[model samples]
Target: MRKEIHLEHSSLKYPLPEQFVQELSEELAFMNEYPSGGSYKTLSAKLAEYTDIAPDCILPANGSDEVIESITRAFGNRLILIPIPTFSQYEVSAERNGLNKKFVPCLEGHNYRLVYCEEDLKKASLIWICNPNNPTGSSIPREEIKRVLDIAPGIVAVDECNYEYLGESVVDLIEQYPNLAISRSFSKNFGLAGLRLGFAVSSSKNIVEIARYGQHFRVNKMAERAGIKVLKYLDYFQNIWQEIARTRDFFIAGLKGLNIMVLPSKTNFVLVDFTTEEKARKIWNFLRGEKVFTVAGWEQEFSGLDNQYLRFTISNQEEMSFVLELLKRFPENTS
Candidate 1:
């Protein structure tokens, strides 16, 4: 059987710290018990310590997906503004709650930077910003986010699930701006995607409201224990994050050497622009035949450009080198 390489979902290629195995083993006996409800006090406290925020300001969920949904339901009664060619969940949550949504197109010529007009800012009650955005892997500037918060009448929820890769955050502004809520996940940096641990950080009041739409005991025990244990090993994951960054840069250089147009990324993935759908499909199909799977841009609802793009997750140097070699030998379309 051929070994398959999956670059579709952006989960980290590294494994969690070895200590987690013992942690989960200890949690196994408690599988019969239900998790604590009402925002999961202990888990929230651990997350609070990790994020350097008040315990009351943390709301643990199944994952960032649930966090986004809760934030959308809690504050998305009015119009919600989402920048396009970004994460699809922002749109999914808005539509699921039956709230009105506006898709703001990010500037394609400008590294896909997010731009919001004063009119849209004032009209929106909820604005979703995916920092180091998914698929595009582009980061929104701190000043830009602050500018939006200054004028936007409602919540500005920034998804920082990939923040560890870039080491940038606006979490400190949560105290200054009551409307700011940041969603983070343990999936990418912590290598705990299977455990499904994520949380929302904001003002204590905002957290209380976000908690309302959530069901009781949404976070399971294994995930709770894992979240606490992982906080102790930030140094371990920080090393891995640095390694991924290095690997990402190497991969980007290799792609560029192939004369491919690759987008700049702060996240753990790179977006490749093939300039046209035909070429993109050809490359994607070729890679798939080689047991290497990548994500196509249109599949993620990437808008504002006809150029077909593909996103590849960064792994170690050997795997990336393998990919580059595959691209080097990509079978030509003779048709």
Candidate 2:
């Protein structure tokens, strides 16, 4: 069978281990009943140990998206503040829940620094921060995040879907700042995208609030088992981060050699700038013709921020080798 590669959505490029897949398959015998709280209880305990937070402080959801939606619902009265060119779900969740939103645009030019004046920061309630931000992969330092947490009177929520990749976590701050919530996903690190597993960490009081407004049974039995099983081999999952970093740097170096302006990223993907919207479109079209797909920087999710950029998830070197060969020609006939 030909190896089908996907460079979108930031799924681990590696294949799932057969042993883990078998464990989940064996769990199919129990589809008749609602997922027991016992599994949830056990998983919560496990995650508590993993996140260093008490079980009561953790709220499991179908995925990070659902957790975000619930948070938006719980705090719907507050005005939502989000940085542009981020995961669009924050905006979508706010719209779905009828929360008013204001986007703070990234500082003009390539850096995309998230800057807001005191008045801008004080306005409204919730602030959505995506660390190692999607598409651009630019990260805000811990001190900067802490500053936001201190200044914002409203809840300061963080989308940390790529947290495991870089070990940059504010989950530790949950105890100190009851107003902060960290959203995390197993889909990126554990290769469980299809399983749709994720959770949130916050003060126990906040967890109670999330449960108050969220779905009653957010996690399924299979997803619970899949997450628990994956945790058993946490070391294997952690190593994938290193492997991806190496592959990302290798590909980035090659792109730089070709004089394609690329941004610094700590996540599993990189943004390639082709200088003009038309040039970027040609590259996007060229890759599509090669049966490869990439996220156009002009997509609505990017809020039309980087029209000449493309978000390409870094797969393994073998798959990247194929992509690189095609990318080598991105400038040939288009000029």
Per-residue CA lDDT of model 1 for 1-335, tens digit only, reads 96899988888898777777777798899989888878787888888887888899899999999999999999999899988787888888888889999989885653776688999999999998889887788888999999999999899999999989878999899889998999999998888898898899999999889988888887888888888788888888888898899999999998888888888989899888887798999899899999999888657545433447888999888888999999888755212
Candidate 2 worst ten-residue window by lDDT? 326-335
Off by over 4 Å in 2: 1-4, 37-39, 332-335
TM-score of each: 0.96, 0.95
Model 2 steric clash pairs: none
Highest lDDT: give the candidate number: 1
Instruction: Measure candidate 1: CA RMSD.
Output: 1.9
Query: How well is each residue in 1-335 modelled by candidate 2, as lDDT tens digits?
Result: 55445686688878787889888889999878787552278888878898888998888788888888988887657688888877888889888777798888874666867675567568757888889888788887898888888888888888898998778899889889989988889988989888888898988888888777665677988998887788887878778789899999999898887777888888999988788988889888888778788888667766536688888999888888788888887765223
lDDT of 1 at 141: 90
